[model samples]
Target: MPTTDNQGSFLNLISIRRNQVTAMDNDQELEDLELFQKNVADLFSGFLASAEEPSSAKSGVETIDSPVTARDNYIPPPPLLSISWFRNLLDAFLCCEAEFKAVLVSGRDPSQFTRPPLDRLIPDLLERSIKALDVCNAVTHGVELVRHWQKLAQIAVTALQQNPIGEGQVRRARKALTALLASTVFDVKENSNGNVHGKSAERSWSFGRRGGGGGATMNNKDPNGRNLSSFSWSVAKSWSSAKQIQAMSANLAAPRGGESTGLALPVYIISTILVFVMWALVAAIPCQERTGLATHLPLPKQLAWAQPLVSLQEKIGEEWKKKEKKGNAGLLEEVHRMEKLAQSLVEFADSFVFPMEEEKATAVAAQVKELAEICEKMEEGLGPLQQQVREVFHRIVRSRAEVLDVLDPVTKLPTPVPY
Candidate 1:
């Protein structure tokens, strides 16, 4: 019923209205994309700011200025916000992924969006998260740190599963986490093992040797029939005689131990004189230094009686050195074992691909959780061993101090007067 001109005008008006509707829709989509970007940026900024804050005692405690703590002595930071930042970050990532997919589905050119590219931005976020976690691990030595890292790693794994674009970053994070956990386990075991061995060595060193019998057991009486109480006196006499002999010989150019003393005293005469002088001195010295008359004997002959204590000290030193060597070798072995395990973990992570099947994903998750539990158990086991090591070390130090106190006066006894 309408005229030709009126129909044409109506079609033109409809076209304009349709164009307006399309423009409005495009504008709303742009605004939404912008809002999504701003939200992502704000969340990430907050997370980074929190992560960068210096970890001090104050972080775990409520500040005086906190409104919730105004009525209380002190309150700890809530577990949800303080410890669950990684989980929150992961949730943000998931949201970002969903928005990005929506943008793709809307037939809008992502390149036209005035924001950072998704490929670059997502990877950067993942990398920063991993670095933050690494800092957390380095600064803290608590099991809580391990647990938190594991949670972050699990989330990262999920992120990788959801979005393949950030796979490289996610893989790197997994490798780092695996390496950290492996090294921690290794260190705990190695330290515990070393401490155990050291404790055993300390016990043997302290209780096995007789205190003043020149390394003989208390059950074994001296073969020469000397009283135990007089052992220290005998040792002092021998040491003094040896020093005198050393001082006298300083001016002489004696042959080395295996070398012959050409045209010296006859062997039989030297031996007989040595035996006679030793008994005479022991009978007469009475823990006193021999003076003028005793200088008639040669320097080498005077040192004979001191040989037992010197030999005993040398044996003790050798035993200590052997124990040290054994401990070092054990530590090296443990380090190598850890290195191998870390390498295997890294390889596994590198080769990993997020399984498409639900069963496979669940299985992988289970395995990771189990590994974390094992590490936790190892840490717990090391606790008691570490304590034992500390106690043993203190005991050894105390016992040594006591022994030195007892021996100090005798060792510092005045040198015998030279003949």
Candidate 2:
């Protein structure tokens, strides 16, 4: 019953208030998208910065008695292939992933997840995440392999650390070092000869053939061998880390045109990060059949995270080129350090005299000290790294299931397989 002019005034005020609300929402969405991009960039920038920093100790052997300042300043080499580096990488992914999920939840219509671009992009991202789960499982097995090596190295360290390194101690250390090197050499031989496929009987920790004895263990004796089976801890012998990485990233492309909104941007960002992190794991951790692994990462410059990511990719690729044909277990810095020290110790033990000279004794002591440091690093870092990896696997599973529920309520995505 009110006049027409009064009714029009009331309607206009309501329309203005609605505009104000919509503007606030848009502003918030934009802010979140920007923060996500900045964090991804910051994560990779930190990796590059760490790589450029100087180390307190030399990459070569250094005495435990080296100046306190040097010991204090001993920053590890660039984080690319180190266990600590990988752990930090996983932490970064977990943070970014949580933010990404938040962005999806905070803005956009829930029904949009079932329409057009989101419908396709999200499902593809989820599928890549599933592939990443497989890589995580393989990497966990690789962690166990590294643990085995650490145990062998620790035996040698305990043998050599005695004040008067005795002949018996030397023999014991030699046996352990020989066993360690034999395992590496066997892997190299098997890889070089294309014998990557395991025989049904090759289900134990056998080091091909021992130097003087028949072999380290019967091919079927050690129960810890990684083989293809239904076990969550093992991967099929035919599984290739390189191939798995390739599969994850093969279809990953940046969003284009209308897909370049805040929602699609996060999907692409996460997909890129997921593939990069997996490639790094395969490169840094021991996995099956890694030869001929390509190291290219194609990212468009429009992405906020592209520059730092591209720089990191280039640095890792160069490192990979240097070690490609060496037939080493993986490109892990600790593994390389351990292998070098072990070889030198083997040579020293082989050419020893009953009563060692001062210079010879000092050199051996330095090597043992270095090996001990590597063991300690692995001991403290691997467990946490493996836990983070498992967390990543489970997180991906939950996210996929959430998305599946949105896309199709009748179908339930399975919980994370034990693997």
Candidate 3:
């Protein structure tokens, strides 16, 4: 047998060899990890670049060499792919960060690694993710806003048709609708090969009917802890359906006289049914505080008729300034309220009837004179309020144009028509 000293030396040599092999294996893993980080970084960079670039669609049948710079020509970035990439990138970054921290805790010196610092990359990843989410949310909100406007337009058009408003009034309503549509931006759908095609008008009203309050549940989490893309997708589908409805309404509004009336009857019946359903649903659903910037700014109560209209005008102006600094953030709720009030006013006006007999006609004429005087008073009171509302809308359109500039610098945003 060997001496004690020799045996000790032999054991030392074996330990040294084992340590060398283990170090080599660790270095290989570190290299692989570095490569993964590089790849992820590249992907992230590409995604940001694409996000910043203006969206373009390949025209299938109509190819034009000259580029169009109008707002109508501008398309929103592809949300599905962008959102997927963001999720994957975020997950990968999180994993890498955790692994890196563990390695650091386990006495591995980061100075030995040639890769970028996890500390720097993680923060950058987080910042980008937040920005991406904001952009997505803003786009989603825009779609919803446009949808609300379309609904209002539909109601207005239907009301005008049913009442047989003068030709001038009909023309004005159509012009307004067209102007609103032209100013709005929408997403372009892509095919499997990533080419955009003209979207078909498929009746998707079922989405709205089926979308219970659950569809708006943003905090919904999956069993496996994965964030579902379904929430955003549902919103997108609803938006698409809204676009279809708007198109249908526009078509129905195109014809004049009995043709328009006939075309609109079915829609009116459907709308009336929907209104009942909506009322029921509204009653069933507990009222929640408005989301976004609107939560903080509440509309002032209407002033008493005894108060001067000037006081009301001042209050509205002040409130609008406070709420509209960052854009028409809370204006949509106000617009909705105004539209409802206008509709009610129209109904109230329609309630009055005059008789054909001489004595009755005289009495009715006096009542009509009184009614006109009251209307004039109401109009005077609302004139400043309406003017302020119009200003807020114009500001919103300008803000949207700025967002479009960031999204697509090449395309020019259309100017908002003065109300």
Q: Which one wins on TM-score?
A: 2
Alpha-carbon local distance difference test for all models: 0.34, 0.73, 0.32
lDDT for position 29 in model 1: 65
Q: What TM-score goes with each of the models? A: 0.26, 0.80, 0.26
Q: Which stretches of candidate 3 lie over 4 Å from their true place?
A: 21-25, 48-419
- Residue pairs with clashing backbones, model 2: none
RMSD of each: 40.6, 9.0, 25.8
What are the per-residue Cα lDDT tens digits for candidate 1 across 1-419? 56998999999999999999989976876566555546544644554444445454234555455576453654332121222332343344445444544443345433322122323322222222222222121112222223333344444444334433245754665666564554344322122211212111111111222345333112224578754211111111122222332343233332344322211111212222222222222211111122221323233433332233223223323432433222121111122233344444455566666443566456545544544444454344333422332232233233333323433434222322111
Error of 1 at 410 (Å): 99
Candidate 3 per-residue lDDT, tens place, 253-285, comes to 122355222212222222222222112111111
Q: Tens digits of per-residue lDDT for model 2 on 311-367?
A: 777888888888844435778889888989999999999998879999999999999
In model 2, the runs with Cα more than 4 Å from the true position are: 1-20, 56-79, 186-231, 324-328, 409-419
Residue 335 lDDT, candidate 1, scale 0-100 = 25
List clash counts for every candidate, in order: 0, 0, 0
